[model samples]
Target: MFTREWLRAVVVVMFTLAPMSVGAEVPWQFADNTRYMAMGDSLVAGYGAIPATQGYAYLLYKEGVFDKIPNTLLSNVGLIGATSQDVLDKQVPLAIDPFVPTVITLTVGGNDLASILTGADPATVLGNFQANLTNIFFQLRTALPEAKIYVSNLYDIPEIPMATEIVLLFNGIVEGVASGFQVPVADVFSAFEGRKGLRLIQRNGADQYEVHPSNAGHRAIAKAFKAVIENN
Candidate 1:
């Protein structure tokens, strides 16, 4: 009953089927058939990746990583270069869709801080940024009541020594505002703090770090977001 040839065939079959079995058994938890919205600036726009088009949102959707409890219906409304005010004016409106129980993710405020840092007054600019962010989320809540909102705290971009303090200030405000909204906030600030000032290549191999993250950086952010989404 246990011939050598038969045993060899059995082992091959087992090896062939093992990966599928494991994948099938993995548990996935997130809503299905619901509309998903990605609202942010260049980070969500996926500035640095192979083919340069696979943002975290697209990656998660294509990989079926969050397709167990609820299938992912995604909309990417992130702009390549959008400030908080710009997102308020533009990105928020694009989230209008028919899908119920939608999930919205956003990252913003860096550009605003940059502008303010160059201006004469800092206090007023900081206050205005906070107010604008709060308003943006409020508008999102009003427009997408059936959706679950997720926002990312601004990434730390000051390790370059030129804007370190200003970046920390911006991130502090972002985190505080995100907390007030009671939404899941991905902490990209901490994840990128150590990597600041380091040159990360874009999909095109151009060295850029003033605003965009490398592929390795994006993966780190995506993993953090995945964890938070799972827990929520």
Candidate 2:
């Protein structure tokens, strides 16, 4: 059996590579009092990293044009350890508290896949992934009809040998759902694959299975938002 320590060590190998920018922009134009809401899982919640609000959602809010012009940027609705179904069931309702968010960001589905990986059942993982994608999008569309939603393409976590195929399967569902919904898909998968020395699993100085982005990875994701906003 692969010891817990051993599993984490192998996962660390996949993230050791560095990231390059695709430069995708945010689709919504910046406006006064423009509200932004981020709803998703640990990556959205800033897992393995303290001060979760310091994650990309807050970072992007800080860099946003509305922040400079007296806009109201609602706090990021990050639900730690939330699965996609959780987002459907929990986060979306909370998003409407302050007002309608003009912009939305989400990074979910990892927990669902991770759950399957832990159980060693790829078939079950794939089915849950497809269901989660449908539920996540359905909830997003239903809850925030006018919000420009950004659903991230799952990052490759082959760094954790226990679940690469599962990750790929989950990502496939995510991509197909994104296409169907007209939601902008941020492709973190393309950025992580084959990149050397990126280190996806870093927690403090050690590594683990929970995949959170480093400063560099967050910058790349932010760039994608910038690109989507500017071009679309």
Candidate topping TM-score: 2
Over 67-170, each residue of candidate 1 has an lDDT whose tens digit, in order, gives 53224445555667677878776666555422233777777776666675456466777788898889987877777766778777756554344566776787
Per-residue alpha-carbon lDDT of candidate 2 for residues 1-232, written as tens digits (9 for 90 to 100):
2233432342232122112231232222223446666778766655543455456665676576334423434445566778777777666656554335777878887777767656757777678767777776776678778878887877676657856776677777777888788887777777766765444564455466657677666656666665655554
Which residue runs of candidate 2 sit more than 4 Å off their true CA positions?
1-32, 48-53, 65-69, 200-205, 208-210
Quote the lDDT for 223 in model 1: 68
Q: Indicate the worst ten consecutive residues by lDDT in candidate 1.
A: 21-30
